[model samples]
Target chain A: LAKTTQPISMDSYEGQEVNITCSHNNIATNDYITWYQQFPSQGPRFIIQGYKTKVTNEVASLFIPADRKSSTLSLPRVSLSDTAVYYCLVGDVSNTGKLIFGQGTTLQVKP
Target chain B: DAGVTQSPTHLIKTRGQHVTLRCSPISGHKSVSWYQQVLGQGPQFIFQYYEKEERGRGNFPDRFSARQFPNYSSELNVNALLLGDSALYLCASSLIRVDNSPLHFGNGTRLTVT
Candidate 1:
């Protein structure tokens, strides 16, 4: 399993864009980058996933570089409710059932 | 359709005691995975069961064991628990045992070892 490192916490104001970067220097060729959002006392929710390049959805966007060593999760127009712990995971989900999570980046959306 | 469901939203146990936690996967989901999340930290993988068989095991001790039923429901059992065992036990279900398959998680059962 590839380990990931992310910022412990980030601060942003409402209506501003937020970008959280994750570093996985040991990422494998078969690994995919996935991001999840978790609120207080709840399970983490799937936000976005990408293998390379950029993948965008209604909720968030994932940008992966050619080296696949790092990825960024961009949240647009943040709101107070968007405050949560964001986790970045790298693995080949097609082959394994286990997901290794790091400490995660706590994004605090303030008004 | 209902999502993954776990029993006994909260539990309090004493050291050296045993505890059983149950989880009912979503309809048609064939894979169930268990995780333990300590406060202020991310969740740690414990076990994964697919089609009533053990698919993967984490670094957990033998005291932690799990089994899946034919219906795809699962139970996590812990024996001779210690104070460090206190944490939120999470159960997630997926259509398959693949990582790409999005995991549907329940609110999790909070276990407190006194």
Candidate 2:
């Protein structure tokens, strides 16, 4: 499993864009970068996933540089309801069931 | 089309006691995984089962064991529990064991050891 490092907490106001970066220097060639959002007292929800380049969905966008050693999750026009803990995981999702989650980045969306 | 579901949303047990937690995966999902989340920390993988067979096990002690039924439901059992066992037990399900198939998680069962 690739270890990931992220900010412990981030603060942002409504309508602003929030970007959280994760560093996985030991990422493997077969590993894919995935992000999940967890609200209080709830299970974490999948946000976006990518192997390289950029991938976007209705909720967020993931940008993986050419090196693939790091990735950033970009949230557009943040709102108070978007406040949650964001986790970045890198692994071979297809081959293994042991998905490792690190101490996620806590995003505080202020009103 | 319900998501993964866990039973006994909240439980309290004493040290040296045994407890069982149950989970029902989404319809048609064949893989189920269990995780333990301590307060203020990310979830830790405990076990994973696919088609009623154990696919992976975490670094947890033997006191923690799990089994999957033919219907793809799962049960996580803990024996001789300690205070450190208190945490949220989460169950996640996926349709298959391939690709980037994202896991669908349940609200989790909160266990408190006294």
Candidate 3:
């Protein structure tokens, strides 16, 4: 499993774009980067995933550099409800069942 | 379609006691995984079951065991628990058929050891 490094916490105002970067220096060639959002007392929710380049979805966008050692999760026009802890995980498709989580970046969206 | 469901949203147990947690996956899903989340920390994988067989396990002790039913439902059992065993236990379901399919998690059963 590739270890991930992210910010401890971040504060942002509402309607502003928030970007969280996660670094996995040991990412393998077969590994894919995935992001999940978790609120207090709730299970983590899948946000976005990408192998390389950029992948956009309804909720967030994931940008993976050519090296695949780092990825960024970009949330556009954030709201107060978007405040939560976001986790970045790197694992292979066949072995994702045994994912290892990091400390995660706590995004605090203030009004 | 119902998502993953776990029984007993909260539980209080004493040291040296045993506890059982149950989880029912979404319809047509066949893989279930267990994770333990301590306060202020990320979840740690405990076990994974696929098609009623144990697929993988984490670095937990033998006191923690799990089994999957033929219907794909799963149960996690912990014996001779200690105070440090208190944490939120989460059950997630996913299909191996889908590449990079994200896990669907339950609200989790909070276990408080007294």
**What is each model's TM-score for chain A?**
0.98, 0.98, 0.97
Residues A1-111, model 3: lDDT tens digits: 899999999999999999999999999887889998999989898898889999999988999999988999999999999999999999963554889998999999999
User: Which portions of model 1 miss their true places by more than 4 Å?
Assistant: B97-99
TM-score of 1: 0.97
Docking class of 2: medium
Question: lDDT by residue for model 3 over B27-114, one digit each (tens)?
Answer: 9888999999999999999999998888889999999999999999999999999999999999999987677777889989999999
State model 3's lDDT: 0.92
Clashes per prediction? 1, 0, 0
Candidate 1 per-residue lDDT over residues B1-114, each given as its tens digit: 998999989999999999999999999989899999999999999999998888889999999999999999999999999999999999998887454777778989999999
TM-score for every candidate vs. truth? Answer: 0.97, 0.98, 0.98
Selected candidate, larger DockQ, 1 vs 3: 3
Ranking 2 against 3 by lDDT, winner: 2
- True contacts preserved, each candidate? 0.66, 0.67, 0.57
First chain of candidate 1, TM-score? 0.98
lDDT of model 2 at position B84: 100
- Superposed by TM-score, candidate 1 places the C-alpha of residue A37 at a distance from the truth, in angstroms, of 0.8
Model 2 agreement with the true structure over B17-95: per-residue lDDT tens digits: 9999999999998899999999999999999899898888999999999999999999999999999999999999986
List the global CA lDDT of all models: 0.92, 0.93, 0.92
lDDT of 2 by residue, A1-92 (tens): 99999999999999999999999999999899999999988899989999999999999999999999999999999999999999999987
Candidate 2, which segments miss by more than 4 Å at Cα?
A: none
